[model samples]
Target: MKELHIVCKVRKKRYRYISQISNKITPNLLKRDFKKDDPNIAWVTDVSEFRFNRKRLYLSVIQDLYNG
Candidate 1:
């Protein structure tokens, strides 16, 4: 790999900045119901990280639960 000029990229570990734990709890508004009848209602979002071509990339996706 060194003779062909190919380098490997290593992934680093991420750490949290906060040290204290909170006791607050958030209510579940969806109630485990993911199915939706309306097109614009019940939108969900997710963030993902990917390593490709020796570069790190972040992807954010937002989709409607009705058709998705």
Candidate 2:
């Protein structure tokens, strides 16, 4: 690409507003115990973000520890 004089453009990160920024840490309640005797007694969820083709994609999931 250097021979072709191609250049890639990257966006600069913008400053976040006060409401969007967080300084507190959340406590974990599950303590890494994934096994449960019954459904709905304990639930787990996760969220992930990916960047592809210059676009952002988010995946969110929730599952019961008993059956999952």
Candidate 3:
């Protein structure tokens, strides 16, 4: 997270980075097994992740266009 402090004396705002307590959502596993007889579904997603520091983290998302 980041914070922007506004001050009249400075031309630009000050920014502070805040660490997070929990990790973000990331993709860990994937599987696809669908037949032509399957019903129509548009979207699917997977998510898991890891946090490096109070201010840093990695996140990922996996998506499928068709039902599979």
Candidate 4:
């Protein structure tokens, strides 16, 4: 029977780097209020884009929350 000894080298510790810059918060105007008592009083609009055959297409829609 024979005895063996092993040796290992230590390496320097590394830390994660993060940016110190802060992001600005924007205020919301609607504040999640989507209810309306009368028609045409409140409306929501949305826009979307799609790409097909190396071309760009855009679609815009307006929705009325009152019975629509």
List where candidate 1 sits over 4 angstroms from the true fold.
Answer: 1-14, 19-23, 52-55
Largest lDDT belongs to which candidate? 1
Measured on C-alpha atoms, candidate 2 has an lDDT of: 0.90
Looking at model 2, residue 55 earns an lDDT score of 100
The 10-residue segment of model 1 with minimum total lDDT is: 15-24
- What is the RMSD, in Å, between candidate 4 and the native fold over all Cα? 14.0
Name the TM-score of candidate 1.
Answer: 0.59
- Candidate 2 regions exceeding 4 Å error are 15-27, 49-58
- RMSD over all Cα atoms, model 1: 5.0
- Put down candidate 1 lDDT per residue, 1-68, tens digits, no spaces: 99999999997989877859787899988898999988887889999989999899999999899999
Pairs that collide in candidate 2 are none
lDDT of 3: 0.52
- Model 2's TM-score against the true structure: 0.58
Clashing pairs in 4: none
Compute the lDDT for candidate 1: 0.91
**lDDT for every model?**
0.91, 0.90, 0.52, 0.79
Residue-level lDDT of model 2, residues 1-68, one tens digit each, is 99999999998988767887689888987888889987898988899989899999999999999999
lDDT of 3 by residue, 1-68 (tens): 13666555655756776676457777543344433343444345555556566555556665445545
| lDDT at position 58, candidate 3 | 51
Q: Which rank order by lDDT, best down to worst?
A: 1, 2, 4, 3
